[model samples]
Target: MQFEPGDRRRVLPRHLRPAPAPEVFAYAIRPARPADLPHVREIYNHFVSNSAVTLDERRSTIPSWREKYALLDRLGLPFLVAVSPSGAVLGYAVAQPWAGKNAYRYTVEDSIYLGPGAGGKGLGSALLQALIEACEQRGIREMVAVISDRGAEASIRLHEKLGFVEAGRMGRVGHKFGRDLGTVYLRRALRPSRPRRGALFGRSR
Candidate 1:
């Protein structure tokens, strides 16, 4: 999909065309790379610093982002990003284990964030749909989204539009910015890949 810059909190880099003509640009969604972590952190820290959309109160560091990237790589989970034609990281979507216990292996939690100028253009939905499909391909049975109830109505609606149903809500579970905050949980079941022939049987061939 194509987008024109609007309401950007920052100016576009010199590589991008100026705003008088409203430069039309496109972005590609693909697996994230190690170098993309910095951009990812920048985007995530924006929410952490400015809004109640996320429960986190501290800015994330590059080392932490690298650790997360490495852990997801080792676990065979999906970490995807959207990059503009000029190679700037526009946004990212990732999945992590829903719980540390063995029984929750088939379930994962989704996280998605877009850059300052990269929202409201179907980008979040695109990234989330891609994440869901990636999890399905990995034999995951369920995906969950835990969103803040403070100022995240857009996020809830986005998840709902992509078939996620409200699983439950937990009130006063988190405190950030000197206010009690809650979480709204949404879940979606995926079509996991079928097992290969004789995979469930004892080895007797």
Candidate 2:
């Protein structure tokens, strides 16, 4: 059987880690609507045009990206955009179900894309934090990040600071831009679904 674009072939993993306070973002977090696809497209295309954040070297079109958003949204996953108060989309982030297997429902892999200006600021963290919260609300157990090993120091560091730990690294699993590349997997567990007392939610029930 052939899997669809967002379909996975394995089961989700179990994650049982503590939850933290509301993540601080220099920008605001909001769900990505269909209208936001253009901004999302631009942000992602920048990475494809200039970075190794994704193995997909080809520039993605708005329709293709919208399809991804629709799939994840249908799965109850969060596809968010971090925008400036003036409404400029700085970055985007979301998690996709890890595997198609029933047991893998709780395990999801994460992805993030940001414009050049969005880096060095708190945009990525803000987006990640929101995604984490969204996952926890849906009873998601584990979130994984598969990052390319080339020039990804900031991404690796951000995940580390966000409570994810290095799980595994596969060497030379990808070849992009005419060079062999490695990728690393990082994971964080979100348990109990509820935020702590006096936390961002203000006295968790």
Top-TM-score structure, candidate number: 1
Q: Which stretches of candidate 2 lie over 4 Å from their true place?
A: 1-26, 194-205
Alpha-carbon RMSD to native, per candidate? 12.4, 20.4
Q: Model 2 over residues 1-205: C-alpha lDDT tens digits? A: 6888988786545465445677454566777778889988988888787778788888899889879988997887778777766677777888898978978988999898887666776667777887888888778999999999997888999999999999999999998888999999999988738533221211111
**Residue 156 in candidate 2 has what lDDT?**
97
Cα shift from native, residue 90, model 1 (Å): 0.6
What's model 1's lDDT at 52? 90
lDDT (0-100) at residue 36 of candidate 2?
84
**Candidate 1: Cα lDDT at 65:** 94
Q: What is the lDDT of candidate 2?
A: 0.80
Cα-based TM-score, every candidate: 0.83, 0.80
| lDDT (Cα, tens digit) per residue for candidate 1, span 1-205 | 4456874365568889664765565788888889899999999999999999899898999999999999998998889998887888998999999989989999999999989888878788888988888888789999999999999999999999999999999999999889999999999999988433211101101
Query: How much does candidate 1 score in TM-score?
Result: 0.83
Question: After best superposition, candidate 1 residue 99: deviation in angstroms?
Answer: 1.2
Candidate 1 ranges beyond 4 A from true positions? 1-22, 194-205
